[model samples]
Target: MQNYFVGSDVGTTGTKSVVIDEGGNILGFSYIEYPLIMPRPGWAEHNPEDYWNAVADTIKHSIEQARIDPRDIRGVSISALAPACILVDKNLTPLQNSHIWMDRRGIKQAQWLRDNIGEARIHASSGNPIDPYYATVKLMWERDNRPELYREAYKIQTAADYPCMKLTGRAITDYSNASLFGAGYDIVNKKWDTALLEEIGLDPDKFPDSFPCDEIIGEVTRAAAQRTGLAPGTPVMAGTVDSVAAWIAGGATENGDMSLAMGTAGVMGVVHKEARFTKNMITIAHAVNSRDTYTTVSAISACGSVLRYFRDTFGQMEMLAAQSSGEEIYDLLIRLAQQAPAGCDGLITVPYFMGERTPVWDPIARAVVFGLSLSHSKSHLLRSFMEGACFALKHNYDLIQQSGIQMNWPLVLTEGGARSPFWRQMVCDMLGVPCVFMKDAKGAPFGNALVAGVGAGVFKDYSVAKQWTEIGASHQPQQENTALYRQLFRIYRNIYEDIKKNYQDLADVTGFH
Candidate 1:
């Protein structure tokens, strides 16, 4: 019998399951979506049970769709949302509602941490700044605000590890998730740094045992088998964060291959042959393996969702059509944007709809639409949206490159955002490099499977796994647009520079939290 592998990705809105033959062709895949709960403003969460169901549904559907026997599945892998703090008791049941990656309840704690830890010191120690988006501040907030809840919490795992724990009946973390919260997980040493743990005042023991991303921690248990419909005792590799998993799928190397994930927010990551960092950006172990490093980070909130917002709130016609026709509203937006030329004819947009994250760590930042003219139409507005998001990435790309890390390759692109040829070309034009779009742009699921393949001895390492698994299409940068975009990018940078004070003042006035 031939060996089959399964890669399960737990994304923000859904869990996706993909089955791959030994040579890396996707046999079949399935996506099971669950509704998101925004209980309060700036808070994002999921009922842990919802996530588990999503995982099980997607897996069973993928296996059945592939028409493959479960016994052929020799290995499994997982990639998950990062910086999500889910507390589970010793019995592996959730302690409380999980505070997802988008939760902002730790803002004040994050602010206090920035002052107490000092930005440069924290960066030097953890390769990350003190920020609310990280897991530590979330954990700190729980410990301080919900003391009894914290005491009752048995383990704190990332979004990816939690489901895997349920599958394997064990608790463990991969390098990618452990390092995100600035909890002193070291990329270079491949171990948790005790000194940094002391500095952050976290219990080292509370952290799940760290494993190399490709290491086989255990297998599917009878319980997980019944739930997910997989063979009991099938080997499941410890997984990495979604972005880390993506870097592998897209072939981001340490020298500087960059993968920009545009989902609810935008995340950019580059693998470094050597560990590296700059102010505001983070450097951590790659999700696939410890031997390599990745400077994982992002910005441009409401990135992909920004277009959805425009269509939903503004383009109500398209939104309704999208719902009825089973086509993305962005597809219509992209076609319209393509009708307009480069530069969107003097429209400047800042995709700060939900405030900025990476490159500029300003939580107080507000979304802006500038340089709009009377002649501008929906096409111009649509084009500017894509351009604006690209500019945000360019801003960070410039910052990440400054760390003096050489890119392994020019560009690596993968994500749901790649569904549009227009978006893919726009990124290439903006970044002035060829972005190889993985034809199978399933993002994290493909990445996690590659990790699992390595762990189960199907592949040798992250690089080798990527070499065979990734089949991609390339988009070379357009020189003319690059020149035009350079000027627009200058203005884009100036907007942030010109509006810093106003952002702070806005934060003061609109304490909406």
Candidate 2:
């Protein structure tokens, strides 16, 4: 007689699925990673078929691992990377690969919008800035370059909506995801800005209708049930973006609550009761209260991706050591980083390998390692790399504060990077804030399951997520480390200001842009 729910996160790099009981305890979990298609420089894409297959596979695997009957599942929900434009035909077949959030090929389109439509007008309407990161610019790029594909498309779908359509045969988006569409979704009014869309020369009909994040959109069809191993009639909720889901799972429900999700991208979400839209951050409707609350977010283009890049590009010796010894290469790298002292002996890195987002919004920005000396070892470089990411985060936080947003103390950190105590402590020192993380953090899938539970009436409300989340560890800022980091952070900020113009020059000379 116990009820269970299924939740899945269709991420940029992969999909994660989990089965949890009514109590929010994860009983089953599975993750499947797919390749990020990079056809050209600054372009990122994904095959829609890969998303559907991964969603189905992960759901089946998680259900099987949970040892539970699919019929007992009350509901299902999904979280996904947002603002991805996937064009589908009448038969729900993708016309082409999706242009994901990381794709920066729409720079010209974004610039056109700023010139013609006006950046302030667009930002005022959508609560998002004019950037290639938005779906509107990407769609413009598609319409301009791939006119045939654009003409043949029936509807535009996001990474989350595509999977939900496959599950329930309904092409719909949630408010949170819809706000980031940037094609004229009015975040404050909670409606499509028809005038804005028309001014931008986009067909408003191409976008789907949006619902509340927890609204039960539809039930799984027989074909979807066969594919996902769920009950044919199991209800599915319209879910939010992956970072928002991770924020919910980290127990951030009330106004002023803050969370940091350290996935491939570092996303920081701050929940507020009023719609305080700032150009410094991306604004979206809160998954918990779609109407009254807003979650403003700042994103770093690369966080864990930078670490992975280092491991793949520079950690050959550590990788070989791991092959010889039964150990994780990440652990070995972290061990090496631990050998270095605070501030990494005057070495600093600006982690802009994939350009940058939030506050800076620089598309041509590249990574920089400054103050490198012969005395600096690989360990020092490794540690400095980590500190660099933290510095970028602090940069965003400082800007957010300057914009008159009050941040709640003891920020909650979640996802992969938060799993490391050393990294967590580094964040504490860098941000100069006490931080706590959830014990046995379940990531976005857990929050998706909670959304399903709410929609299915298995739980009273989302506040239960906090009751279910148990704090694992807490770290206070080390006064000495915080002081040193404050000094280094200033230089980190100055380095970007000094060389930001050079990034574009380098790109123009090399034709990388």
Candidate 3:
């Protein structure tokens, strides 16, 4: 038997699965795109069936392409974009479309949580704020608004856990995903704290069963086998949220080294041996479960997505020209940006197109462009938007540093936006930190593979992760750009403050629903 393993990543736009051998060599991969439905401005939903179907198609496609015998497939691991609220009945049927991590419809519930539970108490216990961005708030909001849906929900789950239950007829989630909710989980002891749950009238049993990371939760079922190409009885390893899985993919096992991911949204995370938190930072449980462990995380709601906005909305002319000329539009955008100086000649952008999350919880926030003049062009707009994300990242970075977690700038395994030299240099120049290009730039898929290795018993621990990971090039900061960005950051901070009343006014204008 060949004994290969598969790692699947449940992405917002798509689900990707990568196959690898015991020796850590890439075998083959597959992906299937899915749609994110925005029925309302603050709501983000996805059909769980879409993700399940994508998983099946992608896995079958990967296996067929890899030309590997089905018998050789050893173990399968998973990760998904999470805090996704999926209500399940006794039969594990989904109650509604998955409420994604980006949904802000739970804000009222989140505020109620903070007010009743106390922000400091919850932050200290769970390591995250009581925001709609986490699973707990979303679940409570669903319970309150859709009583019919809530009444039918026997188990509340996320995108990842729903699949797990479908596969094995058991609904369960890992500690890491539970910790991300931060309102109910006892991060220190790594359990669903009943005292906290009692406060909200939510019984601990109302949620899905929780497991430690790396624990073999169950085996694939006959129905799941039909939905997916995997063999019935294939071991399913307890998986993690996309963020923690991305950390595992980036080799962020040890404390201090940061993993900066900029896919649709942006995230900065540093894994620690134990749960720790500060007012400015949220600590989430690590997917690699054990006592004394969690990840410190800070995020910006919009990063690469803003760049896409600029390319699609503002720079459509240049994008069309490049695409028609058979040139990479992103590459063309970078070239156009080079014509502008480091600071875009006094242009700055606030990337709150999706509203601010980390370091600010204002859902009414709007995007803004500073210092725009008649002289500015498409290149300036493009560059300013790109640089603006970095500035936003820096704000989170500063807050994280203040959280008192001392991380050595030894190595930062960056993925997503860091892949582009344009994006990487902007981060380097803005933060004055040298970010090394990662060897295995694959995010959750790669991490899933490593964890699959552990599941297959190829390696006892995550130590051999180094063999699976590699680094390519390096980018150093420019001193002059550093000074310029410093001044810009001060102004960036002021921009939010100056517009705080406006954001509040917009909230007031919207009225109390």
Candidate 4:
């Protein structure tokens, strides 16, 4: 019988599912977007049912489009946004909307943790900094602010685990996702830090069982099969966090290999065999195997989302033109940006629409466009937007280099943002390195599919990842653009330094706290 695998990525704004054959060929894929609820400033959430339904719908749609028999799908795997906390009952129903990775409502709680637990100790234990972005502070916030929900919570699942429980009736989390649970999981020891949990008054029992990335957690139940259009008893892999999946799919399986995913949020990761605890960067256990290797991640909270914001809020004419001409809105925007010269005529932009991660870790950081004048047109703004996004990545890459970790040249770039030649060129020039795009631009789902294949024994191990990943195009840096970008990047860095304090003052004055 022919065999296939299904990989699903439950992301920040949408869920993507891909059907792949045993050889890693993507047969069909479907993406379903859901709304992000921002009940207050710096808060982000989503109904857990939305993710479950979206996964089921996309799986059904992709299977239908592929024209494949459901029985052929031998295994399923998933990757999801991390540091998100979901409170679910024994029935696998969410007690409330899950707090996503972007939520900063627990700022005070995070600070409390830093003050009480000592930030250095938490980082040593969890391989992550104490911040609102991690699940620990958010879970603490729930316990403090909403006592009833915390009391009724049967299990605190990460975003990936929530869907896994729905599909396989197993409450489990991978080591990669468990590392995001903060001080509770000992990254070095590879177990729940029972002492740490007890010190914080968090029940270690509330956390799910931890597994490796490719470990088969359980089989799909009859009910989940009916709703998701899959055959009952199909094996399911534990999967992992989306960033780690991107690392695998981007062909960064070897140590010192780096992959940058420019999705709604930008993430740059370097594959490493040893764990190093840095001040701002996160050292997550690699998904391939949690025991020996690690991956250092620097997350940019807003990357492509800044372009998305520009499109939704100000690109009405471009949207209408694309609609009439049957072109993609991003393509039209790229064409419009081409009219503006490099450096955006001395204009600089900071892409912090949703604050920042990595390096700064400031949740109150705000977006700023400097040196704007009547002379600058919307096209210039658009060009600056692309440049700013690239600059943010460069900033993180520089920090990684400063940590004495040098990545291999020709860094593999994946995700929807890498599909744009214009943006890829910008990243190459700004970072002064050759950037290579992969053939499969479908980001984490493609990676998740490969993990499913590995777990199902259709493939022997993760080395198959390199065979599945192929280079599509290489964008080399132009010396002229590189020199010009360095100058602009200096100003970009300075502007953030000058105005970062103002962001908190403004947020406080505006009652965002």
Candidate 5:
């Protein structure tokens, strides 16, 4: 019998699962895409039941594909998109749709916290800036707007915690996810800040217990075993945030190394020995060393989503051709982009479709396409949109450097976007650095399985993570493309400044309800 470990990643667009052996080789993989709910502008949500179903289905699918006996699955771990607000009642039933990271409906609550408590204080205590993207602001929004739901919720959980609770009947959150709580978690002290919670009028018991990523949370319950096709005694490791899992998977476990996860959102993270609080980007406790070290994240809300939007909205012919020729639509788009010029003939797009994060932190920001001309084609549009995303990432990369975080060269690229040679080259040109690629960039799920292995004593420690990850190719920047991208990136910055106030004006004019 072959012993295996299972890992699940609850992401923004879907849930992905993988089965891996002690050697860190993936034997099976599966994904289930779900819909993102948009009841109104700047509001994104998903039913908590959907997450539970996705987790169960994907786990079963992975095990079936691996041709493994259920009893041979020794351990499991999960990674999830953080700052998601999942409130549940006494019976652990969801109160309503979860407020995911993409949602920005808590602007009023965020400003209130900033004005009342001061942004500097929040940053000092939480190692993060006060923004609608964090959990507390959304909790405040529910407390103020949906008071009934707020009063009835017994415990507020993160996305990763929810699945763990279902599997183990234990309500607990990992340090990485707890760091995003609005009431503030002391990164250095490794506990929830009681004073901050009291100041915000939040009950401490309402939050779940926090633990380190590799610590075993509990054994899989019989109910969960029946639902997920796993053994009842299988150990469940306390997992981590999705980007941190990507970091571990990319072999950026030590200081000075960096990792980039370009999934639905673009996340750039660097591992550090000490916690550095900055108002510019998010700072969270690292999964590997939650007690002493930290991970700083610069997140862009919609990088891959912008590309998906173009494919769904404008690539009908390409989609049809791909179906007939047995080629992927993304491959067709990449080919089309290759035919276009590097700068897309002066076409520019600012991908703020769901506001902006990281340096700008503007929830009102909107997407814009400049320099459109009659000569432009679909290929140009696609390439320009990709360039726009690169520019956004460059902004965050520069901010990370400006914040005094030292990084080793050749940043590791892990996730779906890393598979595209054209996209990797664009990132190289925009950031003016070499990008290291990995052979199995299956991302968070793979990393989660590795963590499960460690927790189950299948591996010695996280230090063995480097042995599991292998580098594939290195993409060096073209000096000419870098110079050109620098100029375009400058214009990109200026364009945002020039049109910054117009976003609010448009919102006001449209009666932004």
Candidate 6:
């Protein structure tokens, strides 16, 4: 009579589900990829129905794969991409495609917010800076451009909330996701800043009620059970953003615990006991201690996706070779990258493939590859690309340190890119921090399962996460490489500073923004 829990993650590019036991072993896992709708430049969207369908399909598949009795499952939880604007009508039908986290179509609205509401006042209330990255700006874009749709909407939901609502017919958001709304969520008080919302011309009523991450918000209905293969009336917890789930999965339950989640985007989260806010970072409630603790996140718009972009755009030969040789194309690319020496022989890259998030909140900035030489081969280009991503991470880490937050050493790395030993070593050398990751970590879905276990009373508390985390290989900084990266990192920063002012000009000329 062992209890099991299910965790579902609706991500930017796909949805994943997992079933785990009390000991944190993954019993079942399923992932289904989906396309990101980019109808226009600087716009990213997803049909809300796609999220629900993927969630249902992945959950059913995971349950089937687990080969466990549905009745034995104690609870279910969800994690999803944060701050996405998904407006739905009274019957819970989506008004339109969701404007996801990567969408930069609200740049004008974000600028208006800064001009009218002032950044200081907004930051004082929301604990987030004025940026198109926040849902508040995206909602403004909807209201201004699609007035009919905005007026007809019953409630605005996050990516996570929409699926939970589908599961239980309840529209609610957790504190971690709510803080990213940025319209007027008081991070310190954990409530909507109604006055600030009013000043921003946003209806506070459009937002849903908020709860702690582990709170049992509702129970799955018979209809949802039919679709997801779960028992009817299974308890559903108010989960959290996917990054927070990844943080918990990487053993970041205690204050000062820091983890770098390198998925489609690179997100670095640091837990703090007190509510410390920095203008350069995104601050939100911690998934484990939803009330008292907070986590500051620094994100890159693209991380692993940069490599994906390279593979799709330039790795035709490797792809064909992989098809014949039965090897992963990524492994082949990394092998080629291994041929290049440290510093890529004075070549550097600034990985702002989709603008950037922290350190510099530039929405118009594009990726830059500097010092490309005639003598450089594809291997050198590939290695510089990887180093460029690490440089962007180091840029954020330096600022996090300067912001007066102490990050505990031996930083934990998790998710996709962290699976690569070469990338892990690069991060260690670039940041001068020893790093470790759990072997075969299940990422966000695993953390969602832990949240479910906590809410279902299968576990005492979130501290069990740390106890269950299995540390694998550890990487230390190579002094020679660290010294070279330090020098190159300075040049990387200078390269951006020198050319950033022209990014918007390029965007304007090209009509991309």
Weakest ten-residue segment in model 3 by summed lDDT: 408-417
Q: Rate the local accuracy (lDDT) of all candidates.
A: 0.77, 0.88, 0.79, 0.85, 0.85, 0.89
The estimated TM-scores of all candidates read 0.91, 0.95, 0.94, 0.92, 0.92, 0.95
Better of 1 and 3 by TM-score: 3
TM-score pick, better of 1 and 6: 6
List of clashing residue pairs for candidate 5: none
* lDDT value, candidate 6, whole model: 0.89
- The sequence of per-residue lDDT tens digits that candidate 3 reaches over residues 302-419 is 8878767777887778878997999988788778877888889999998888678787877778889999999998788888888888899899888877767767574464755666
Q: How many angstroms is residue 141 displaced in model 2 relative to the true structure, after the best TM-score fit?
A: 1.1
lDDT of 5 at 18: 96
Tens digits of per-residue lDDT for model 4, 421-496: 8888989999999989887755788888888888898888788778767799899999999999999888999998
Model 5 lDDT at residue 259 = 86
RMSD of each: 2.8, 1.9, 2.1, 2.4, 2.5, 1.9
lDDT of 5 at 220: 92
Q: What is the lDDT of residue 240 in candidate 3?
A: 78
Q: In every candidate, how many clashes are there?
A: 8, 0, 4, 0, 0, 0
Candidate 1 worst ten-residue window by lDDT: 462-471
The alpha-carbon lDDT assigned to residue 505 of candidate 3 equals 72
When summed lDDT is taken over every stretch of 10 residues in candidate 6, the lowest stretch is: 437-446
Higher-TM-score candidate among 1 and 2? 2
> What is candidate 3's TM-score against the reference?
0.94
Give Cα distance to truth, residue 397, candidate 6, Å. 0.3
